[model samples]
Target: MSEAFEQYERKYCELSANLSKKCTSASLLDGEQKKQKLSEIKSGIDEAESMIRKMDLEARSLQPNVKAVLLAKLREYKSDLNNLKSGIKQITSNSLNAAARDELLESGMADTMTVSADQRSRLMASTEKLNKSSDRIRQGRKAMLETEELGVSLLQDLHQQRQSLLHADDTLHGVDDNLGRSRRIMTNMSRRMNRNKCMIGSIIVVLIVAISLILYFKLSK
Candidate 1:
C-alpha cells in the first residue's frame, strides 16, 4: 500500500507539473496553435485523471487502514487535479478571448467593445452555468466513484463541447477578419468620395465667381 501510494504520488506530481506547464505556455502561442495545444493538453489531462481515478478505486478497495490513507491521498490528488484543470480552462478561455480581440484589430473594426446587450447577457449566463457545474463536480467526487459510466459519458460530452467551441470560435474569427477588411476598404472609399466632393465644390465656386466678375465688368462698361 505504501508503495502504491508512493507511485500514485509520483504520477500525480508528474501530471500536475505537465498541466501547469501547458497552462503557463498557452499564452505564448497564436490562436490556431493555442487551440491545438489546448486540445492536446486537455486530452492528456483526461488520460491522467482516468489513471488517477482507477488507482484511487483500487486503493479504496483495500483494508480499512490502507483505504483511509489511500482515500485521503486520492482526495488530495483529486483536489490538485481540479485546480490544475480549472487553471487550464481559464488559460484556454483567455487565449480565445485574445484571439477574438486580434480578429477585431486585424479587421479594422473600431469599437470592439460595442457588444450587444443580448450577447453580454448570454455570456454571463454561460459563465454562471460553468461555475455551477464546477461546484457540482467538486461536491460529487465521493459519490462519483460508483458511477464510472457517468464519468466516461461526461468526458465524451465535454470533448464534443470543446470541439464545438473551437469550431465556432474559428468561424467567428474568420468572419470578423473579413468584416474588418471590408470596413477598412469602405473607410478608404468614403474618404476618397469626400475629397472628390470637395474638389467639385471648389471648381463650381470658382466658376461662379468668374462669371459674376465678368457680368459686373460688362454692366460697368
Candidate 2:
C-alpha cells in the first residue's frame, strides 16, 4: 500500500480513538454542551468512517493476511460507526422530545394533537412523490455533468491528436526536402562521371595513333 493509504488509516484510527473518548465523556456535560460534544464526535466518526472505507478499498492490493486484517478492522469500524449514528439519532430524538415537552408545559398546553389516518396517508403519499421527483432531478443533473466532462475530455484528446498529426506532416516535409537535395546531388555527380569517361577515351585513342605512326615509319626506313 501507498504511504498515503497508511496515513489515512492512521488518521482514521486516531479519529476513532478520539470519538470513543468523547462519547465516554459527553454524558458528564450539560444539555447543550452534551449535544455539542456529540455533534463533534459524530463529525469525527463520519470522517473516520470515510477514511476507513478508502483504506479498505486500497487494501485489495495487499497480501492476503494483511487484507484480511484490514477487512476485519473495516468491519469493526463500520459497526462502531453504525452504533455512533444510532446514538446520535437517539440523542437528537430525546432532545427534541424534551424541548417539545418543556414548551408545552410552559404554554399550559399539555395535550398532544393527532392526525387522522386518511390525512396521514395522503401526507405520506405526497411526500413520497416529492422525494421521487427530487431524486429524478438529481440523477438527471448528475448525468448531464458527467456527459459534459466526457465531451471535454474527448475534445482535449482530439486536439492533442491533431497537433501530433501536424508535427508528423512537418517532419515528412523536411524529409522530402532532404531527399530532393540528395537526388539533385546524385544527378550532378552522374553527369560529371560521364564527362570524365569521355575525356579519358579520347586520350587513349590519341596515344594509340602516335605509337602506330612511329612503328610504320621505322619499318619503312
Candidate 3:
C-alpha cells in the first residue's frame, strides 16, 4: 500500500476506536455530559469518513497488483463504518426516547435534522463519485481516438511504400526488355561479320589462282 493510504487507514482506526469508547461512555452518562459525548462522536465519525474517502482514492492510485488488495480492504472498512453509523443511530434513538415527556417534541425535531444531514452527506459523496467516473471515461475516449488516428497514418504510409515498390518493379522490367533487345542485336551483328570474313577469304583465293595461270601461259608463249 502507498504511504498516504497507510496513513489514512491508521487515522481512521484511531478515530473509530475513540468513537467507540465515547459511545460506550455516553451510554452511562446523562443530560449535558451525554450530549457532549455524542456530539464529539458525531464529529469523529465525520472525520473518519473523510479519511476513508482519502484512503479509497489512494488505493485506486496504487499499482494494479496492490491496488486490488487495497480496494478490497477499503470496502471492508466502508462496511464497518456503515455498521458503526447504524449503531450510532440506534444509540441516538434510544437516548431520544428516554427523554422526559416535555422534551419529546424537541428530540424528535433534532432526529429529523440529523437524518436530513446524513442524506445530504450521502448525496454529496455520490456526486463526487459520478464526477470521477465521467473524467475517466473522457480520458479513455481520447486515448482511443489517438490510437485510431495512429493506425490510419501507418496504413497510409504502408500503401505509399507498396506503390513505390510496384513502380520500381515496372522500371526493372523495362530495363530488362531493353537489355534483351541489345543482346539479340549484338548476336546478329557478330554472325554477319563472320559471314563477310568467309566470303572475302574465298574471293582472295580465286584471285591468286587466276593470276598464277595467266603467268604460266605468258611464259609458255
Clash counts per candidate, in order, are 1, 0, 0
Model 3 agreement with the true structure over 10-79: per-residue lDDT tens digits: 7987886676667656655557887888899899989989999898889888767567656666766676
For candidate 1, lDDT tens digit of each residue in 1-221?
A: 45665576567667766756665555455568878878878987887787687777778778774566567657756776776677666666666666676677679774646533433554455455445544554455445444444544666797899999999999999999999999999999999999999999999999999999999999999
Name model 1 segments beyond 4 Å from true.
Answer: 2-5, 111-221
* Regions of candidate 3 where Cα sits further than 4 Å from its true position: 1-110
* lDDT for each residue of candidate 2 in 1-221, tens digit (9 for 90 to 100): 35766687668657755665565455334368878997897788779778977887777777664565456545655665565555456445545655676577679776443323433443444345434433443454455446546655766797899999999999999999999999999999999999999999999999999999999999999
On lDDT, the leading prediction is: 3
Error at 145, model 3, angstroms: 1.3
TM-score of each: 0.47, 0.43, 0.49
True-vs-predicted CA distance for residue 130, candidate 1, Å = 19
| Candidate no. 1 TM-score | 0.47
Q: What is the lDDT of residue 29 in candidate 3?
A: 59
Give the residue spans of candidate 2 off by over 4 A: 1-124
**Top candidate (TM-score):** 3
Cα error, residue 13 of model 3, in Å, equals 43
Candidate 3, residue 5: CA error in Å? 42
Q: What lDDT, from 0 to 1, does candidate 1 have?
A: 0.69
lDDT of 2 at 112: 42
